[model samples]
Target: MAYVDSADRGRIRLRRSSLICPGDDTKLLGKMETVAADVCIVDWEDGVVPARKEEARRLTAEALQKAWRCPERVIRTNGMDSDLFETDVFAAVAAGVDSIMLPKVENAEQIIEANLLIDRAEQAAGREAGTVEVWALAETVQSVQNADAIAEVPRVTCLIFGGGDLGADLRLKRIQLGSNRTLGIHRYEYFYAYSRMITAARAAGIDIQVTGFTSYTDLDASREDAEISAQFGATGALAISPRQLPIYNEVFGPGADDLVWADKVLAAVDAAAAEQRAVVVVDGSMVDGPFIRNARFLRSLQDLIDAHDGSVG
Candidate 1:
């Protein structure tokens, strides 16, 4: 249920932008340092063909062993039901990745089994048993249905929403919404999926990450998608390209307007404290305990992001 401190060069971990790459792509793997992301996830599933899985695993192991600039390093292993899942977990754990992302997870039992395997991997590598973390993706109907239970699983720190496979699973068609725009491969169709994942992760006291906007070439589209995600309470987003990182970071992190609001709230709260008042009104709106707490949380999140960006040199 608890974790130990790892011995690697740790940075302040944030989840604004996570860059996903195939494990076997030597070019992308080599360019990891140059990518702009808060986290780097090397993939072992979908990214590689069946024939090259073993090769990808070996290369992925090597990539994990090598140092990268990301504060959090993650490995996305094959599904829990796959025969190769054990090998993927064992190799990733031995290589010292910060998290092991369990894909296509349907329920807590898979996470429980995966946790046992991760514990063994950690022990086998002579590291503290709970140091490596577990991340689960809500990619299927079953997964989305059981998201809350999965998030409540011990050591499952973050929950991700994968729309690609999910769309396929649901047989989701490109339906036209009010704007007359068909739900083209953008991160827009699954509003229900987003809400469920967000609520589940938050309810379980964990972070939530949305899959990247597939329209990588369209920065405006990415920004719009990121705004939608942030508006819906997503803490972070995945990025298929380095170009999407800035948009995600900007949209998700506190902006100038948010900072201004936070400052105003803090000022009002401080004034309220001076008057020995438990609640206050700001901008003609009620500011209570919960509202003040949210303002403080945003300020703290901004502070953390600033500190990490400062240390990125």
Candidate 2:
């Protein structure tokens, strides 16, 4: 689902899970249709070797043009300074992808340059301007420092935390990036960056996604990290492998208790609305503007799930 970001609406996309498929691998791309992910990102960056960048770009463009089961399809392009960046952007725009994920963003200037390149590509291909969105990669210290500025870029729809690269840049050990806790201290290693990223995204009314937890074989650890991320207000996390998808989806999806609360809140709001009232009480709790808004948002997720599975009945 495409997430609608706004101050009043909050994060509206069920990005509970996102899968990154290596663009050059046709076999992997073929499996994308069967995967249950909110977003399928055809990666043309780290997943593809430098020598095969062109092939990856070509494959990504082709994949984007074809129909897929995933709701939101995005192409993760090479960095703005790379030789393949222009070609990646041009192909993605020409193919009319849902969005272009630009990695290693440091400032608004890079976003502006990428947006301009996308604009030129769209015009050349006779496509509508702004048809393609931009997702900024906040992996570097510089990028984290200027996160608010980057979030202000008009083409940017979301900011992704590249935990692996960011952790390395901070000289943090691999274990530190995992779900290990020392003296009951959570992943303080990423506290500063996570705080800044979330704050910037919320302030700009955009979604912020988290990516890391390289231990694909360890579902428990990944779930721990995901729980912490949710507590810190991350909209979602990227699943590097197909095996990680279920864990992420479960972690981000609303639980049974959440649904029960939403049902009550929504029912009370409906009754109040029918009575020409703006407030109501449910389970000894006041149901007002905030309660009604949250209840509707929760129901939206169920609606999306039902639509995706053709289970609306």
lDDT of 2 by residue, 1-313 (tens): 1222244224465677888988899999888867888889988888899988888877766766666777788898887898888988888877768788999999999888777788888888887676677789899888999999999887677899987778788876563554454523357778899999999988887788898466677788888888888889887899878888888877777767888999998888888889988769999988788778778877888777768768312
Question: lDDT winner among the candidates?
Answer: 1
Per-residue alpha-carbon lDDT of candidate 1 for residues 204-254, written as tens digits (9 for 90 to 100): 777889887776787887888788889898888998779989899899898
How high is the lDDT of residue 164 in model 2? Answer: 70
Backbone clashes in model 2, listed as residue pairs: none
lDDT of each: 0.82, 0.80
Q: Name the best candidate (by TM-score).
A: 1
TM-score of each candidate? 0.90, 0.89
What's the number of clashes in each of the models? 0, 0
Question: Which ranges in model 2 have alpha carbons more than 4 Å from their true place?
Answer: 1-11, 173-175, 179-185, 276-279, 311-313
**Regions of candidate 1 where Cα sits further than 4 Å from its true position:** 1-13, 174-188
